[model samples]
Target: MTPLVELSGAGFAYEDGPPVLRGVDLALREGRALALLGRNGSGKTTLMRLLSGGLRPASGVLSLDGVPVSYDRAGLTRLRTSVQLVVQDPDDQLFAASVEQDVSFGPMNLGLPREEVRARVEAALAALDITHLRDRPTHLLSFGQRKRAAIAGAVAMRPRVLILDEPTAGLDPDGQERLLDTLGVLSGTTVVMATHDVDLAVRWADDAAVLTPAGLRLGPAADLLCDPELLTAAGLRQAWSPAVTAFLRAHGLLAPGAPGPRTPQALTELLGGRPHP
Candidate 1:
């Protein structure tokens, strides 16, 4: 399948400081959730910024849908239309006084007709389950509601790719679950969420891309996340799911031979007929 976005041999640095990302090659596919995993200073956010065209590569190439992305004003405008980024900090994205105003900003700026923009805003707010907040003051919203509003702002643009940085950072358990469920149902949009939460990454992403100082290593989420060595090399601790470990040991399927549980239901089914460990 043609990727929604691609980066080849791309590199970035800050004014001659040591390179944060180099020789990185990656492709974001359609309709799949990709988890960007790494420790601090491993360049995950740098890569995300590059993906969003917020930063251009110092070397190499980036393309969307097989066409190379140009950073010119017109091209960048088109890029932002197709690929929207939701910053981790809600305050960074939401500046309007009212929730409706904030969510309508993207589509409205895209030169959409007033009715179309209104419809998009209404749909976006519904998608994020923040419809009741339409007329509420942005400043009065809690952190979680603000995050949803920020996301709705991006969704109103109807982008093909949605990039979120640390989306679950301050969300409560219910908020996190609702957000994850919402991400799951966003038809035709490829979701790329950068998270340090290994467990969330493992359970949510279909494919995993790990970032180290050396570059990127991509694979099935199950394989990349369960490998302690790979996680350790990327300066992350192995996030072992108890259900996965118990099921694996019970079946004597460890490491190389095991495709452990990706969800709680799968874990339950695996141990359904077996005796307790």
Candidate 2:
């Protein structure tokens, strides 16, 4: 299948500094979840902005579903409608007085019919499990609720690809789990998330990519999370869950592998039995 989004040899730089992104190439396929992992200032946010067409690449090409994206107003608007980006801070996206209005803003801005906008808002709220928050004041919501509202706004746009920058940041375990479960059920949409949570990436993402001062590298999440050396190189650390380590050691599967755990299911497949004790 053709990729939902593709970036080829993409590079970007602010007015004064060196290029934040250099020769970055990525292809996000439909229904796949890709985790973007790196340390601070590794250009992950720059790459996200480039992908969402918020910033044009200084060189190379960005395409959506095979069509090249240009910097022209129409081209950029089309790209924005197809690829929605959720920023790290929820407050950046939630501007409307009420949650429903905030979620409806995107579709309404697209000139969708009022009824369609309402349906989209309702669906998005339901998808994010924030239907009860529909009439609440956005400013009064907690951090996790604001995050969900932001996500709901993105989903309301009905984009084919969802680009999330640090979706799990600043959330408790329960909040994180809730967001992860919601993201997991969003099928047929290409999801690319830039996050610092190695464990969440290992558990949630199907594939993983790392950005370093050197450049961008792509591989299976399991391989990346398992490799201590690779993690160190990328300015990340292994998310060695106690259950995962015990399972791997009991099954003799911890000898060596790719850098990361990849997924919780990998342990079951490797062990071929219930985890010991």
Candidate 3:
């Protein structure tokens, strides 16, 4: 299947600066939740920017559904219509006075009719579970609400691919859980998030892409997160899932090949009926 988005041998660097990324390849399969994992300066944001038409590749090709993306205005419009990027900071994206206006900004800019823009704004607000905040002042929203507003702005664009940078950052545990729940409800949209949260990646992502000094490695989330050496090389700690799995195996609670739980609740359940060691 053709990737919804693909980068072929892509390499990028700031003007007059050393190469930040070199010879990178990535394919985003439709309908899959992918986690982009890397330490700071590993080119995760650069890769996301390349994918979302925010940056044109300096040395390679970026394609959408098998077609090379053009950097021209019309071409960028075509690309952004299918791909939307929500940056890490909500304040960076939220500028309008009200939530409704902010969310409507993208569709409004697309020359959509008023009714269409209103409809899109409402739908995006509902999708982010912030419909109640529609009329609220954007500046007054809580950090979590602002985050959702930022994402709602992108969702209003109705992109087939949603790229989020550090989606869970600055949220408390409950806020993070709610945001993850909202992400889960985005039924047909393919979600790509760049995050430093290894446990979230292991628990939620279907696929994982890790950037290492060597290059980018892409595979099933379970396969990638379970590899201690790979995580170490990528400058990430092993996620709790694999650590728990290993502990269970050593304790005779799980077979050598038995799959481990992904969440804290599941881990608690797995240890149920057994005395604490």
Q: Point to the candidate with the largest lDDT.
A: 3
- Candidate 3: regions farther than 4 A off: 273-277
Prediction 1 global C-alpha lDDT: 0.88
Which 10 consecutive residues of model 3 have the lowest summed lDDT? 268-277
- Candidate 2 structure quality by residue, lDDT tens digits, 1-277: 7778899999989999988888999988888899999999889988999889988899999998888987899998989998999999999888999999899888999998899999999889999999999999999999999999999999999988999999888999899989989998888888999988888887888899998777888988767666777678889977765347756666777875433244556565555756544
Global Cα lDDT for candidate 2: 0.86
Sorting all predicted structures by lDDT, with the top scorer first, yields: 3, 1, 2
lDDT of 3 by residue, 36-109 (tens): 99999999999999999988899989999999998999999999999999999999999999999889989989
Best by TM-score: 3
Q: What TM-score does candidate 2 get on C-alpha atoms?
A: 0.88
Residue 224 lDDT in model 3? Answer: 93
- Candidate 1 lDDT over 35-55, as tens digits, reads 999998899889989989999
TM-scores for candidates 1 onward, in order: 0.91, 0.88, 0.96
Lowest-lDDT window of 10 residues in candidate 2? 256-265
